[model samples]
Target chain A: MRVDYRPRRVSSAIAVLAAAGSVAALATVSEQYLAVGISLAGVLVLAFGAAVYRRGLRVLGVPIALVGVAVGFAGFGVGVSLVGVYDRSFTYTGELIGLLGLPFIALGVLPVHRRLSRRLVSLGFAFLVLGVVFTGAVNGTGPDPIPLLLGIVAAIVAWDAGEQAINLGDQLGSDARTWPAELSHSGGTAVFGGLSVGTGLVMFNADITGLPLESLLLLLGAALVLMVALYK
Target chain B: MSNATADTTTKARATNTDAATDADAATDAEVETATSSSYGQRVSTDADGDDLVVEGERRRTGRWRGIVAVALFASAVGVLANTPFLLLATVPVAAYAAYPRLTGSPSATLAVERVIDDDTPDRGDDVEVTVRITNTGRWPLTDVRFVDGVPPMLAVREGSPRHATFLWPGTTTEFSYTVGAEYGRHQFDPVTALLRDVSGGTELEAEVDCDPATVLTCTDAVPEVPLRKQTRHSTGRLVTDDGGAGIEFHRTREYQKGDPMSRIDWKRYAKTGQLTTVEFREERAATIVLLVDARPSAYRASAEGEPHGLAYNLAGAEQLLTALGETRDYVGLAAIGREFCWLAAGVGLEHELTARELLATHPVLSTVPPDEDPTDPDEQAAELRKRLSGDAQVVLLSPLGDEYITSLALSLEASGHPVTVVSPDVTSDATVGSRLAGVDRENRISSLRQAEIPVVDWTVDEPLGTTIVNSTEVMD
Candidate 1:
């Protein structure tokens, strides 16, 4: 089957999402010092994504996208500060927004069809979610569990759908017979996503405080078996 | 009565002119008398006009929409959740999406022009080509990148064909490059241009039609060629065959009725009571047909950075044509390609010109040689045999890289036509495959020589003229 591999676009899309999630999480942080470090990481991720997407420009694309993103963040930050409404959250968010440039830079420089880039993108999003959850816990006034769960579910679905779309487009580009393959692939991904969301909801609601160690071990074994079955 | 007839013809001609004048008077009086003559001249020359073919169009490659949409969604979510950080992501995406929309389509107003230093260069001459791109629209083009479509036959000698620049309205940007001319008629391809906005989101790709009239016609001059010593019975520069009325003495014979008085031996008459006649060998011209193997397999070069075998064959053919022309012999040309190409044997200025033009521009003699022959070897040979004169000799020019060429030569020799192979060596010992090919080629040449067909195994490193001369000396 013909497959048109476009790793750059897919990686860039994931990076954009991760940077956005990082900015949203950093906006609520009270400690300015911690926000600065997190914001810089977000900016780096955005720059990497920008670089990856503009790979045709070669080494030149990396610097162009990174510098453009940095300049954009600085300009926005300065404009907001002039308006007298700049705060620790706004500064941190601006810095995190700078992270959107990472994808552009990554897209420009990274080679296509690399599994590592995809894995890194997924990990980046995971880190963003964990950071948000950690911030909420430290504040002692966390977001509602249901909305946060829905958001996470939405994020996962978007990411999976984007990946599938890229794959489908690539197959079509290569003139491959994609209808049957795409249909089954999409169905499988949807089922996995639904099961994960359902399990997360169940775990959140279930009262495990009084459960015995033996029973907990039994639940862990059952979960492992379910995961294996799902994998196959 | 003859005077009356002449007067009658003159009157009729005058009346015809008057009739033409009456017809002209019926039309607009402003029409000049020279118009009719000029129109006739134009109609005669219009048969060979240049053709302009435009290919490719501007199309949008939507690469950035998905990312923009995802960024927008994230920003909306951030606004709803009172998170300023998510809104920051919307800034870059919005700018990227809006940037392309700000600049309307520039392809409609873009004009490309190609200029070459020499359109009709000799073979091996370097030609400089300059491509100019101008924006005719009112809006300035923020980013532009273009790659010139250089002909495949020619290789770039200096500079690159690709360039990137930004142009303002009514401004022009150009890039120049040089390419080495090869033997063929090369038509320039259209230049491909890609224009993008400041945000690098949307791209408009277009194939710009440049100078369609720009063409390079590279021709080789005839070089000194060497031929074999063997000659047939015909009137030519080669002295051959039995005794006749010629310079060198053959034998004395008894005087016959048709014997001229000058040929009678007066010394023999004084010595004995007998009349003898003197005879000399007759000199006859060779009828030769130069055959070039343009098959796909014969298109290989000796190494990575060398010209292909077909180029060498053409040079050899040109040389042979010159040699045969000097001898005032009947010479023709044939190329074995997808289709069998033949030029009839003749002797004249027009014939030489036609042969040279065919060698330089025939579709069978493409710069980027074809890989396979459409017709089988047997069919091609039959076609070649049909066009060949009965006693005409064949000089086969090939790389001998493939076995089929050897078979073709042997078959022609077997068919009563004396065949001489002038094979250009296009194999090297640098690599194993090349080494094997070189050995195989050597075997083919040796086998042909064993069959008594004169084979000139010309090496690529040696000059063609020197090789031909050495081979002829060896044959002698």
Candidate 2:
């Protein structure tokens, strides 16, 4: 509860963004049969949100655009990466999340006001982080997927917060002036992922120090996330 | 406020043609330009009895003209070429045609406000010029150009009219220029731009509609040196001051019986009216031909980060005439660079106006090369000296730049005319180069002093006015 609001916000934004990216990548993993619908939904949602930011109106259009685009690639990359590891239905979940994620991003861009946006942003952040922690507990440390998930979430928070706060002075957008918020809610994905892997390694293996490996990897992820959000 | 601004800009371009027509050759030049859309509407507006707003814009006209020309040409070429590429070109053509209607300078969006004009500069003073421009446009701009226009007579070759800046939408930029002062008018010309496309093909030319009639004027004041310094006479000014009436103390003359009671210096009369009353010597100055020596040898060192010494002398002379313009003094400005520069002295507003016109003006070719045995003013002054002797004062503003001119100053002083040498001294103990230059400057300075001429040894480091006030106070 006492955790810095800005950091938490960054963590949440990054978590959501990372989750969406993961979902986007996984959308096609459902293989051709299930991939199309989920991918299309995600891309359509994203584009519609951007459209709204540009033209101002119609939140639904972005989801439609995100779905079309995300699905258009159709489970190809995901199928190649995951093979048969994940259940095909995961793509549907990924699709649904991306769809939901689009509106939040658009709203983030457009600003629906404090009460609604804050609740949704915070709640979403909690779910992703919890999911990462739970995954880490189950999995043996080092390279645990849970920390990876959390890092993505943290990255999203950093970028979204930047978009929300900075107008770049010359344009209508103001997320972060030059850097992502120090709190880096979006970085939550990287943190959760790192912690999960780190703790899992400690829990399972006694010889290696989870602290160094987890910290180093997570630090690397955090740096990468900050660059993505700020360099542009 | 927006409406007021638009209206003012419109009015500036809409000067009365008839009034302009009656003006002299100067007005003739204006009349020729008056026919342009930028002007000539004042007479029509008054004649029509129409109270309609004068609508005009800086960018709109340019855009529309280009758009119209391009659209018509593109359409014709599209039909003639009958190719898909030409058809593709049609999109750019259409964009051009639509741009004038859709994209504009958004007079209301961007702003050119809070214009602050410095006090009128004398002929020689350097005045600060500041202009603030804001971007009220929708897009981000990488470069903005600000052009500050002065009267044609004052245009010099060395400076630029534009200073570059960047402005994002809603961001403001301020531009400034510092140039030597001259006479006549200096106006704020409308802003213009060549905006590059994101794709980098077509350039969007935008011009802001603004008032160009804004006038900046400066007069000259008489050169104030010490009492020992003599004044030189020029054919340009009429120097004799008769007893019309003035404030400066004149002289004690035999008292006439019916002299006005007011003419009697009460304090002096109280002591001795029987002896006579004080007649304020008719306070007047001769037309002073300012002959500045601007050769390479005459070049003097300036304080760090400042212009050369000769520049200060030039500015000083201009200011003197501008101040003198305020009084009854007639002042003419002359300079001896490679060639002798001359300004005829005149009276009242005309004299001040002429000096201002000259100070801000620079000769197209400033250097007097050694090979070119140019006609020096000292030689010319010698000829004019005999006729104008006992009449005009010659104020020479120089870096004392060279030896020949230094001797020229002495010779002029020896010629029975009061001469004031304004030396924008370039020598300094502070300069390493000066240390090696061997009191060359000191010797020249002393030589001018030996002639018993009043010398205003000005440094670019300190203001000429400080030296002037100090020197003149001793004389007074």
Candidate 3:
């Protein structure tokens, strides 16, 4: 009767795909197909580990996660290629794939340690966002903006859905039928992501290239005030 | 409002501030008084007679704090890097941060009722429990998570006690689970409900007291109890040392003038030309007292979600009492726990009924472990020794968790009473401390055996009756 909090199938799918999307964005900017292949493979292997862990088989799950992490580290070693297109070219973007290994390992352990896995998942998402920014800003060639924005949005949605799944597992055990709540939560996150992209598109169309620094500062201050008002 | 609080407090019969205050805001005092008057004060006023609602503490889980921090970080990075794509990501993050705040806190206006399929089930039968919850409030509960309080003594065999769903205003939701019934009566506790807003923010927690206080009573008579050779002068099942007229064989003696012809050993007489009479072992009743260990230390369970040691000990006592009742032997019950309990040994249908009833419902033998060790163990033992008759044999049902129980068994054996120890093994190897405890329990069991007490080592995995039968056979 161990209550397992391993992310369900839907949440696990979102997290893996968003993580891959992050790596793919890096690959799209740098033309590194090898890194994308290696990262996606790591994601697939981690999925297997999550499945094995859910079946209460820790003996097999641990080794599978260890192998997946080893593969991911190999990718990390290969992804750190210097291009020096922007002010800083020290791209640790390879860690976007490597960092997820910890969470994948946490996902398979019995009585899934909620706090530790949560921290690891957030840490992996942070690495993904940091890598996306670095890969977009420092590409020797002109970086594509569409994939970069999609990658960032995907990262946030992935974290949201994964966290929701963990909580669902905690509150209602694995034996419970919890798809309705999980699906609705994930759907909400996906819709929110779409709205964000639309907002970004609208701001892009407004031609902010000619705006002055003083106006940008004033806009930021107004936005801060609005946030404070809404918070209350 | 004060009137409502006072009424709710009286009905609940518990010193809970949350139930009192929460009832005051939503329910009127006059309506509450009318409901209490009609229902006789046990049922809550918010819903039907079955449901009792008490508000619980509220706290933020802070699940989305990382998203907020990510949004701030992305916005700072985007403004410096002049990247609008990164800046766009901050919009969704900020929305996530605001979503929970915009959603109103869910109210604790829910009516819950639990229905047990069979109130009196046979041992090992699966008893189904269905719970129905209705949203009695004006607003819908977007995310309602609840766990039914399945009795600890019963193991859930089918489905889950936990559920998460949404219920609109005046709508109902249902979930059911089945538990395998064991011996004795098991009472269900309150249902714990956690209500979260649509955005999974602002949780309202409460305990719903569902009536009519479902209790599952499972009883099965044990066919035989292996008692020691000690016996009373009364005719009963136990074979005694004194030779008389019985089915089993004993030694032969020289024939007397009044000896019956059927009892004469004709073959022996022909071999030695001697008149001899055959003597058979006598059958007599045994006065047996069942002592249960209900001390707090005996409440340990081997694993999570399993019944504790005292639960198994009591169950064993029930089986023994039922088996011993069918025979001519006199059976009595006693407990060493928070409160002292004793029923004098007697033999009859009425006495059997009273002993069984007390064994099932006595406060000292309650399924819930006591809060503290109020009585001195030595003093309780002395009291028990004073109450027991000189010819009575003691059958001690314990877990042998500590050395004190082993000493109790030894002292009883030393006091001229034939003692038999029925120990339920509840120690596990889940941790270093638990493993060490298991070893310690093993040492105590071996020491009791060394003192010549017949120890029935009952493992939880096997049936208690089978274990008892097998162990007693080995002892013979």
Candidate 4:
């Protein structure tokens, strides 16, 4: 049997994305009964994508991953329309959605294809958003947006950390001497994760009383600073 | 007249000494200075000077940018939806964006000291290398990652040469690793050091210079090689063609006036009723030259981690030389490469040492093979013919990986030197190319054997002694 062992970056990225996609789909399905079909389809597509990617059929794997994303969005729309029948509390629904993305977060972090893994992470976050937003829209009382936003932030951080870890693993695979540099880089990224969680908690409690125009101007300034800081 | 001659000799000796001193100074200067380039950076300095410093540009990976954009989008959505919770999502994004300000840029004042347990090691010996990195700058480095550049050819035997740690001002950290030495001069690759901020947003990569290189010499003291059935016209252990006064009897000849009493052949004389003398087959020393094929084509290995065919041929040549030397036969050394290397045939302790040094340290048989062939086949063969004595036999050590080698062997045989090939098999059946190469090699070996040249097909899996014994038995 021909094993499709791709470059370290490609394989790790693919694995991460597939895992994240699975988690996102599971989260959406648990929020609404109507979303079960879409979740199943997303899961099926991602699983196939992983299989084909491992088989060295990258051309087929990517398309399958994309199809899963489409299925996930379709499921979100269907779940929103049928959310009235399910009378679960917003907190329970929100917690389940948050918990559902965990498996995908774990999977997304696996060393696979870097690009595909990133895409899977985005898809997973999309599924979480879809579930929370639809449940809120149908219930006429949206879930606590703070917790939902926190979950999205956590997913993004996980994806970033996973990417760094996979990249380090690739470096280590090529040369053991690269471990020091890779480990240091990984440690630096880990600090970001802690900072992100801390900032989220602080922002959840802080009250910002300012004029709308002033707030918009402040946000624009912050965006410009962020762009400048992150510019390569 | 004696005084004048002595004065002239003294003046000449003084001038020669001055020239010798000047030459030694030039060579010392060259040895003291070394320069190397890695990762697009060039470093040049005296060997005893402070280590060369290479600095890289600070670059951002743009990871936090995506989160920042998402935060901005969420804020906009929050304003429209009148949800404060949506706006709160931007907190982590803004914090990550500003995290770089908490840490300073990586310091350039980093020193690397590399120490090896053995600078000159024997082949296959493990050498332990310790690299100590010190932070000389005032700022405390939050995250410093370094990988000691080990040569690609050497295999790490134990431990790791990489480390990730935090170093304060005037602090030092070290990592140690062991690598198995192979025959050749191996230069350590520059140590790659990467400095990052606490947020991992910015990176500064640099290559640090350490020690120059390590040299490994493979030595052969005694090698037991099986001899072929056919022996040349030589007075040695091998029985030869002509009859002379020796232990092995040839025939009974008519007794001459000067015949020795011990060789009178009394049993033959008693039976024939006539005086007779015993004659034995003549045994004389044979002049043999061992030629190792160090051509670019012969530098191939069957597997990635295995030594190339040239290495095997070198070892085989050493064994043959040792075996031949034991029998008190005149043995010489020659290499077929870009440049022809030849040593005159002689027998003695001094000559053996010279042969071993030539085989081990000759530039032609370097660890890494040269890219281009400097000498053509005709020129190489002509040089070999010119160097070899009229009665000297040739022992050609080659992989027969290419057609040119077969032709070269044939040319040597045609030039009146009896050629015995001890080809080290370096082809495998792993891939399609390798399988085809194996077939090509087999064909070449068969063609050489068909041309009346005695070929010892040596497989790497078997010992040289065993292979030579089997080939000799087959020839007999």
In order, the interface RMSDs are 18.2, 26.4, 3.1, 5.9
- Which one wins on lDDT? 3
lDDT of each: 0.56, 0.44, 0.70, 0.61
Candidate 2 lDDT, B172-217, residue by residue in tens: 6665545556543443334444342211122344444332233455
Please state how well chain A of candidate 2 matches the true chain A, as a TM-score: 0.39
- Poorly placed runs, candidate 1 (over 4 Å): A1-232, B1-50, B54-157, B160-224, B228-234, B245-254, B262-274, B371-373
Better of 1 and 2 by DockQ: 1
Query: How high is each candidate's TM-score?
Result: 0.53, 0.38, 0.65, 0.54
- Candidate 3 per-residue lDDT, tens place, B1-476, comes to 23432343254322112233344534444334434442212333444432367788876766765666666676666667765555555666677777777666887887777778888898788888988888888897777888887777788888888877777888888889888988765667677898877667677789886544556777754557878788888899888889888889998999999999999999988899999999999999999999999888888999877889988887788778777877999888788888667888888876666665555446677676787655887888998899889899999999888888888888888888888888899998899999999999888878887888889898877777888878877887
Residue-level lDDT of model 1, residues A1-232, one tens digit each, is: 1123443243334434434443343443333323333444444544564556555655765665556456534533443344344444443443343233333323322323344444444444444444333332332133333334333333443344344434334322322222333333334333443554455446545644245555644643554454334323
Instruction: Give Cα distance to truth, residue B262, candidate 2, Å.
Output: 15
* Model 4: fnat (fraction of native contacts): 0.28
Q: Arrange candidates by TM-score, highest first: which order?
A: 3, 4, 1, 2
State residue B288's C-alpha deviation in candidate 2, in Å: 2.8
| lDDT (10s digit) by residue, model 4, range A52-107 | 87678989987886676456455545555555456554433543353344335334
lDDT string, candidate 3, A62-175, tens digits: 788667666755555555552234333365343244334324422422224656766666766776777655654444134345666676777776667667667777677677
Q: Looking at candidate 2, what is the lDDT of residue B419?
A: 77
Across B410-474, the per-residue lDDT of candidate 4 in tens digits comes to 88788777788899899988999999999998999899999888898888766677787778778
> Is model 1 an incorrect, acceptable, medium or high docking prediction?
incorrect
